[model samples]
Target: MLVSLTREKFEQIIPLIATGAQYAYYWGKWQDLLNRLLISVVAVVVILILDVVLGQGAQALILLLGVIAGLYWLWSPIYWASLRNNQYRRFPYSGFWRGRILEIFLTEDLIGEEETVNQRGDLVINEIRERRINLVIGDETGFEIELQAPLQRLYKAIAPGQIAELLVLSRQPNLAKIDKFTDAYIPSLNLWIGEYPYLQRDVFAEVSRQLGSDRSRANLNKNRVRKPPMK
Candidate 1:
């Protein structure tokens, strides 16, 4: 199921959108922009109020806090893009793979420890757990791997036995040596199940369509082979 994917092929298949559009999409819509702007404005106003009320003694500290907020608002987009570029750096060599989801189930997972105040006002650390869906996928060769993802709205539609697609990466150009893997794309559900969104949605869809056609043809050939000749 795994097919060789060179860097040239990867770049062609996984195209990145324009920087402006990508930033807007990843950073969110007008609501997010307003929230960030509002926080920066609030911090500046608070700093001014502190300077007037608390006098010059605390001006340095107050201004520093305001500057930090402003800086975060200004540099957030660049910081986000830097994080997004990680996929390119991590997977120098990769391959496309198609498989079938063999199993699907939910499992409770410990997320973190949260501090809560009890009725008596005693603070206690409590374990936070959430149910997450886990999927097991395999190829016709019997090579199976488990892919775990947080339950999202689209994931509810995914069932066992549906086709699953993913990009398998390797340190070397060897398909057998699977060094790492990108998130799994469930074409049937039009959903990607993973912690991070590695692939561009439009480009991923294009690649999936090509693979789907190939799969259809393969099935047709198999069916033809299975049919008995006329007596």
Candidate 2:
């Protein structure tokens, strides 16, 4: 199920690049939002105290804090956009691969750890766990991969036997070796599952639809050609 991506076809994805970038802008590193807020609050209080006592040096340090905050918030969108284009150039050749959903379930994964005190007032790092969607997908070649995604309405409806389209990376023009992969796109749900926003959903949907239709036609033709009786 490796469909080649041509230059002309790839160009269609250009118009939709901004969509992915925008998505990255808003939702990127969302898990760290609380920590960022706490840090900013603490930094502001420190700067205010220092400014009153040591005006000149505090002003310079305060300016640096602003720069750091801006970078932290903006790096996701900027980096993702650049990487998207770089991937296209570096891997000029591309292919489309898909797998069948063998199983779908939910699991609570340890997402982070935070320092906290217990009833006895002891300092300890507490585990932060969150429910995530887990998937087991198998390709026609019998290669299976396990993937996890944030639990959302988009992933809740996944069922066995549905197709799981994957975005894999490889240097070979034919995708001879799929050593790394990015995300899983479920055409049936019109949703993507992964930690990163990597695809232009519109283009992915269009391409998936076309591929689905083409495969259906091919399968129909194959079925029409009856096999001869075994001697």
Candidate 3:
């Protein structure tokens, strides 16, 4: 069920899935920058307090620890930002690959938390949901690929055993973006259903309708089963 697509056609589909609102990109770079900045500020305050309490003898030790911590906090953000920028710039020039989806699953994670006080003076935990999709796809030649995508409604529309295409960056295969997907297989009908863009919102509604119809037909056939006359 693999459909080979030209680079031009693949680029056209890239925008549908390659959105800027990915959870990984946000947590990996932006949130990371803020976290490091906060840690560095706290470290500096601690070092100053230690210097005053321990006097000149411990000043050298305190300075050494502070320097190491400062370098660590300062380096991460710079490296991450540059790497992220380069990835985005190279996406348009990446190669494309197509495969049939063997399996798909969604995962939800609590990446961070916010604290709040309730009316009764109780502490509340506000958890952030980070959703992602894991997909296993295989090509005609039997090569299989495993991919994970950040939170997107498109993942819900896709079902197991559907044909899908992906855009693969030569150096960064893990960041491969989903390009398109076909409808699920109907067992009784023995057919592959409609094709839709990966980002289409109406796909879920259409899939629900098709599934409802199939369920009704299956129940009707089961009720039609005749029992033999028994003693």
Candidate 4:
């Protein structure tokens, strides 16, 4: 069936998106190490094959390849280490994979309903059913982060107050700060609502339809606007 969606319906499933920096922080470590190891291993295997194909110059070729591979092996870890170190300094409360710092909780300790206006002109309301923790970078975007499961070691580096400061980057956009929220699993972070949008699809759709098509179109048009000309 070709399902058609009302604008309201589409907004309901607007999946939360993560920022690129957080994305890199979450998955970069293991992938970087694996890639470096793969490159070094492949270089060695290729050198061995070259040695077999050209018997006389095989050893010399292997030696040269070995030198290059050794250089890569030495440099890759240092490079990766430096990059990770820098990222940690910027987002100490954020999670990482390569190092011993296990998990960083972004949100903590809140109950009941929460609402805040977002930068994108959308209102976000989070109903804190229970104590829950979601990692987030300190930015106006209020982007939420998800870390790899099975977090081993916990970092006691950045205090809870510091993380709160990063998330509330600006005073504008009607950001709502919820205090005393606690997450049992990860009890270090604070909970804040940056922006969450609500839709009429859930219970209002039927009611709005009864009101008439004119009302429906008006509701739909309110949320949509004409795009500006590219030229």
The collision pairs in model 3 are: none
Off by over 4 Å in 3: 1-31, 53-64, 77-115, 139-145, 152-231
Candidate 1, backbone clash total: 0
Tens-digit per-residue lDDT, 142-179, candidate 2: 87889887788756578999888866656777777766
Q: Which tens-of-lDDT digit does each residue in 9-87 have in candidate 3?
A: 4444333333332223333566676787788788878888888988899877998978866665655544454454444
Best by lDDT: 1
Off by over 4 Å in 2: 7-93, 118-121, 220-231
Tell me how far the alpha carbon of residue 154 in candidate 1 is from the true structure, in angstroms, after superposition: 3.5
Tens digit per residue, CA lDDT, model 1, 82-184: 5665555466787888899999988999988989999999999999898788899999999888888777676778888898998777778776777766678
TM-score computed on alpha carbons, candidate 4: 0.25
Greater lDDT among 3 and 4 belongs to 3
Please provide, for model 4 over 1-231, each residue's C-alpha lDDT reduced to its tens digit, 9 standing for 90 to 100: 012233343323221232232333333576666776788888888877877888885687679887788567446544443454343223212111011122346444444687888899799997764434344323334433332222223433333333331111112222232211111122133221222211112222332234345556878999998999999
**TM-score for predicted model 2 compared with the true structure:** 0.67
Where does candidate 1 stray beyond 4 Å? Answer: 12-78, 214-231
Which regions of candidate 4 are displaced past 4 Å? 1-42, 70-75, 79-160, 163-231
- Per-model TM values vs. the true structure: 0.68, 0.67, 0.36, 0.25
Model 2: lDDT of residue 164: 87
User: Candidate 3 — number of clashing residue pairs?
Assistant: 0
Error of 1 at 83 (Å): 1.8
Residue 37 alpha-carbon offset, candidate 1, angstroms? 8.7
